[model samples]
Every structure is written in C-alpha cells, then in structure tokens.
Target: MKKLSIILLILGLLTGCSEKGTYIKNTTPYDEHSVENVLMSNEHVKLAKVLLYEDELLAGIRVNTFSRFKKKAIANKIQKKLEREYPDLKVTVSADSKILLETEKLINKKSEKNYRKKIDKIKSIEKEQT
Candidate 1:
C-alpha cells in the first residue's frame, strides 16, 4: 500500500506539471483579446484577425473600403499601431484580399511552419504595395 501511494503521488505531480506547461504554451506575448479589441475599434476595419506567435504578431484585417488607393493607408495605420504597442514583436499587417484569403486557409492548417510561410507571403505582398 505504501508503494502504491508513492506511485500515485508521482503520477499526480506529472499531471500537474503537464497542465502548467500547457497554460504557458497557450498564452500569447500580449493580451490577445485587448489587441483584437484595439484593432476592431478602428472605424474603417470590418474584420480583424490577430495571432500571436511567440513575440511576433501576424494580423490580417479587412478594412471597409472598395477603393484600392485607401487600402495602403489602412494597412500602414495598422502596422504602425501594432509596432508602437509591441515594439519587441515583428509586426506584420495586411489589408490585401489575397493575404486575408491565405490567412483563412491557415486557420484550417495551423502549424508553426504554415504561420512562418504566411508571414513571409504577407511581407512580400506588403513590400509590393509600398
């Protein structure tokens, strides 16, 4: 009975550690909800998707504008806000329709590799615009 108690204690400790580790893994560098709220508060934005990957931020936002010329301003505004708020993070923002579509695809295939690829694509797209 003493040996069984010891084994049970070890098992309980192992389970507790796993749960704590999971909480850390799930947490973002910043307050994810507040970040989302800040972006959504913009009058021009319709949809804003923000994901925190460690210290980097990957945001795909859809602004309420049919004019292509207005998109650049909107994207730049978002990029500035994120950079200002999270100086340590490598912030990448996009108002491009193509980037938005790609982001939706990543929602289904969520892997670190996929996020890296998506960020690269968004940056490339951002470069082309600017």
Candidate 2:
C-alpha cells in the first residue's frame, strides 16, 4: 500500500510539472500556426503567452526550472528569431512571470478597445525591471 501511494505521489508531481501549450491572442492577419510552431521549437519553453495587436508582437514565456538560469537568453533568442520572420512587426519577448501573467490577462479580455493602452502599460512595467 505504501509503495503504491509513493508511486502515485511521484506521478502527481510529474503531471503537475508538465508543460502547457502556448496561448496566442492575435488581432492581426498573421498566421497563428506559424507563430506557435516557432515558439514550440524551443524545448525549454514551458508556457508562452503571446499577443499580436496591430504592428506589435509581445510574448511572455516561462522556461522550465532547469532553464531558468538562461531564461533571459532564451527570451532574446525568440525575440530575434521572430523579428527576422516578421520584420515589419515590433517584437518584444520576456520570461518574467509578471509579464506572462499580464499577457494572459490581456489574452482573456472580452473587448479589444483598450488593448493598445494595456499593452503599453505592460511594456512600461517590463522596462522598469531592467
């Protein structure tokens, strides 16, 4: 009975750590599938929240615990790659939890009227941390 309990606990923990797929909210004409493919190509990314509004592309990603040390590098690499793919759109990517949470909130909003203002606020908050 004890051995069974132990095994179940381990399974529970592992399941809890499993990665959730990317969340993308796009208001533009861009192909969402291609963007998702680009983000998922990196093995270290655990969860990603992306918002595409007008000419701006903002992404907030969470890396696996083991990759936390290089999370900033990962964010930068994703940003550069995205910029190369979508040169006309301004790209911003960050691995900060605050940014991730804010981006998720933006993605879940019912209306799009204040998207630009809220996005600007989130960007300023991200800038303040640097």
Q: Which candidate number has the best TM-score? A: 2
List model 1 lDDT by residue over 1-130, tens digit each.
9999999999998774331100111236476654665676677766665566766676777766464468778878878987888888888778776766665566556466767667677668767834
lDDT of 1 at 109: 60
Candidate 2: list runs displaced more than 4 Å. Answer: 1-19
TM-score list, all predictions = 0.65, 0.84
Per-candidate Cα lDDT values, in order, are 0.65, 0.91
Q: What is the lDDT of candidate 2?
A: 0.91
Query: What residue pairs are clashing in model 2?
Result: none
In candidate 2, where is summed lDDT lowest over 10 consecutive residues?
Answer: 30-39
Candidate 1 versus truth, CA RMSD in Å, comes to 14.8
Clashes in predicted model 2: 0
